[model samples]
Target: MRLPFPSLSTLPPTLAKPPRYFPTLISHTSTTTTPYYRPLSRSLSHPSQPHHPQANHSTTPPPPSSKMSSPAPAQYVTVTPTPSGYALLTIHRNPVNSMNTLLWSQLQAALDRCEQDPNIRGLILTSGLSRPVFTAGNDLTEIFAPMTSREQYARFWTVSNQFLARLYRSPLITAAAIHGACPAGGTAMSMACDHRSISLHPASSMGLNEVAIGIPVPAKWAQLMATLTGQGEANRLCGFGKMVDAAEAKRIGLVDSLVDGEGKEVVADAVRWMEKTLRLPDVGRVITKAHFRDRLSREWEDEEWLRSEAEGAWEMLASDEVVTVLGGVMQRMSGKAKI
Candidate 1:
């Protein structure tokens, strides 16, 4: 039977790009009808950058790229305040830049700093270096970590949602420089910002895939998407776990515009947009942002509601459905199951 929405397998070539960057494989024909494989990419000769386990095993892939080094401890999330009036928050988590509790805490601190500083009129969020993933959502390993108590789980969700809520309602203008595979939590963060500029590369895509993995999308997250892309598109994208590339994302208003290159170039594009936004009157910008986001602000401020939502997040993680779905995802990630 045909499916209404395309699965990863049946999606068109445009939508079939892998979430992670893999080395390209070269093959030659032989009389035995078996193809021999060799990996080729610019990163192969570079000794500094190590390849992750899941590369090159997929059915043919892209060429090898440059080596990406993990930044030192103090560089995880760099907050650089410019003299010209804006702060840049660069996400530097290495080996797929996944968000864990620590990163979220650091991010929250950065946002707080930006908000409090009168000189910092706006903020920009982007990956620190030239890496494949621009914050590969929540670090799945961390999310699925053993929870000794429901309170532990609730606390995790609370801090995460709090950061997002802060970003969504920040008086300063915010923009996301999304250059790579931005899914799940990453998508939510991008949507929370005022503007998003995604890279114009095939691998650069963004969407909320929480439901496909059996976890419900938080109500605040759903509202954020609906606020950005309208209710119909938000419903389709969230419900189906649909991932779209940069061009289509722009067309549907998931992202504001597309940047030409990856890494620093994407960050530069976003900074330029933020600079433009900052040219407007600060009072007008701040007031307008609060006005449109009043509903979200109200919801996040409701103490009981916040606690209940956090508890719901914990319960979902503890559910058997999420466990089984995560198992399947792990299988696929480990090359034990076909996509």
Candidate 2:
């Protein structure tokens, strides 16, 4: 079904009102500092002016320069507008586009902007790098770090859940153009999209590899997997953490279609389908999709998947075996440890 795009210039008057504020009571002090009420008046007097605060004897010490000068985190995901009114978001982080915390946050922000933009009718999610790997999944280095805390892990998982959930529920149609290895969280990402077009390269691997990392499939991942390949398939895939080749993925319906050769044509074909299907008069496609998937997502939301992720992260961090195994994998790959 075709969804009408909202005009930005014609937004309702209610949205143009002054920013709302919540009232808070502040404790009074005898210190000779400018009162908050006076600052409010000054702000009203010169709405467009900037004010620099002067330090007083009783004022708190300024935070270190390093803190003030810290740069905003870099955006790992790149969004490019296409002529087809759809955008392509490429996860460009090198050999394996592992979804680190920074990448996850960036992805959410990109999706948010795309969803709000009237010109963007749909989106094609893919990696920037060529095949042999689309994404190897979450950054094992971050996941297996010694200093990683349960709270941090939980926050990471929560972020991932929110990002994936939004993609699944986006008002615009979404498609995943996968070329190479997409394991663990990567596979979950493809499944979250409305359609997945994969390349049939021998090197391409796809599956849920969470068990290998010693974590049970969280509710969101499990639900998406189940949606793509039934409960039985999802159970086996998650339980075994098996990585399937491209051919096996298509055979089992894990992937919607396999692109010939290197899969460069996959995105073009997906774009064609999106253009045709998105124009359908009936909005049932989008409505039905949301109806079916929202039920499962709600179950996940109720379970508090973020909290579970944090707990799992804490447990994984506390495990010397997990740390040793991950370190050994990295060292062996680098020729610093015996295989």
Candidate of highest TM-score: 2
Largest lDDT belongs to which candidate? 1
lDDT by residue for model 2 (1-339), tens: 453443333322211111221011121122122222222110011123333446665456566678455564555687787766778887877657878777777777677566545566678888778646677787765566564666677777777777787677665679888887888888888888878888777778889877775556665687677777789988888898788887888877888777875656877767777787667532444445555565565455443556765676567666888778767666655732111
lDDT of 1 at 319: 77
- List the global CA lDDT of all models: 0.69, 0.66
TM-score, every prediction: 0.73, 0.75
In model 1, the runs with Cα more than 4 Å from the true position are 1-75, 145-148, 335-339
Task: Report the lDDT tens digits of candidate 1 across residue range 167-279.
Answer: 78776789998888898888989988888988887788888878776677778888888987899999999898888888988999999878888777888888888888888
- Model 2 residue runs over 4 Å out of place are 1-68, 301-303, 335-339
